[model samples]
Target: MGKLIISVNTKEMILKSYEMGADEVVISLNQCSFNGLKKISLEELDSNIPVSIFFNCCIFPEQIDEYHSLFEKIQSLKIQSIYFQDPIIILWAREFNCLEKCIYRPETLVTNQMDANWWYSRGLKSVSISPLITLEETLHMIRNVPNSECVIHGHLMMSYSKRYLVSAFTNHNDLPSLRNNYDLTIQEEKRDGHMPIYEDENGTLIYTDFVLESFNELPILMKKGISRVFVNGEFLKDEELLDALSIYKQIMEEKDVQNQIVSFFEKYKETSYSKGYYEEKTIQ
Candidate 1:
């Protein structure tokens, strides 16, 4: 069976998630104040689970000094897989001879099969499909790259930027909050929907109006040989994350757990969830 991979930023989750049936780990520090790079050096002690560092901090091509420093850190680490959002960082990865360990996450936008194959040919292990694509496009992606990953659950990242929009308006532009994921959120004026917004070193990031719940589609994904799943637990409390993890674990492990999982969700109506683009054939 395909394994479930959850993205986390805490030392506790980094160590315990695999115990909860997470087949692998994606350590995301973008949402936290702690230096994730340093934290990985200290806490990445568990060798049983495959761990990938989620690097949202991408630099400009002209930043040669920064690239040199980053490459040194990359070389010093024992990790092999890295989930990064910078297209330009590919040059740094190649220079450091670590391109094969890179899993390009273009939260900048979605990607397709042709794009996945293109990157695979270049040396990247795999790529993430855009959350905005249609179910048909999603099928084509997994069929094309059997090892490619897609976000199956969590709040979908709608947008990202280098500027902190919140701090700009709050008169705290000079001070980037170094706390855990902030509580600031934005709601659409036209509709009764809201998206979670947070800021850190990488800059401002926005999430979808509703949680992306594709639990019912697990059967199709698993049957198609889709190998990996990206789960988000950075914002969830311990109990909430465990419960969410349990639901996905059942869906992947059981053949006839769809109805039960649906019932489980119906019983817990805590988060307003949606199927997103799962029902559509293509994005318009």
Candidate 2:
């Protein structure tokens, strides 16, 4: 059977995921500041299920100590593994002598043998398959490297950048700063004698007809030997989450592999949609 890895914030989602047939749950500490880490304790995550924690934020060199502390706490939970994206974090994972417990680059796919070899040299055991790749591309890459694990299900983050897109908008408007909540917000700007330009949270300027929906590409993903899928809870609202979870659960329970894949793609076409970068193919 294919695996499901759900990214969660609160404990409620963690418990709900198990009930929804999730194979694993990863707690994303993306927005938590250094001070916020004090609130989460190792005892809180001591559950029977397989849980992994991930530092999804952009890490700088100055934050090494905090990262180390976070890794130490994660180790204490006896979780299966933890994931990091930043190169510095990967280096730190190796420096701390905890490379065995870490997974690298969750949202990007490795297309060539050189990329795969580079990750292996860095002590990376698993890498995420990029959502942008077609199902055919994913299969070819996976077949090339049969030993590496792949994240099969989850919100495909369109982009990752250090710039705070939200802050730029508010600053331009002379308004108070907004908290980083991970929701998609639009920013409008009126140029001299021109129409107002809109920007999303990632600072990617949006056109009027830009697409902004998630896609259901799981059926194609499953056939590619994708054992684990990481769903981003921070991106979906409550209703969206329920809808996605239901669709995912339905996909997982079906016994007929070929038939299920067909059904999944059909239902996914209705549920998953993408806009901006994923749709436009424009990075910035």
Best by TM-score: 1
Which candidate should be chosen as best, given lDDT against the real structure?
A: 1
| Per-model TM against the reference | 0.83, 0.68
Measured with C-alpha atoms, the lDDT of residue 167 in candidate 1 is 66
lDDT of 1 by residue, 224-282 (tens): 88877777654445555666677788778774666766765776577777888777545
Off by over 4 Å in 1: 30-50, 61-64, 74-80, 172-181, 255-263, 281-284
Q: List the residue pairs that clash in candidate 1.
A: 110-130
The per-model lDDT (C-alpha) reads 0.67, 0.53
Please write out the lDDT profile of model 2 over residues 68-93, one tens digit for every residue. Answer: 67666665465766666666667666
Give the clash count for model 1: 1
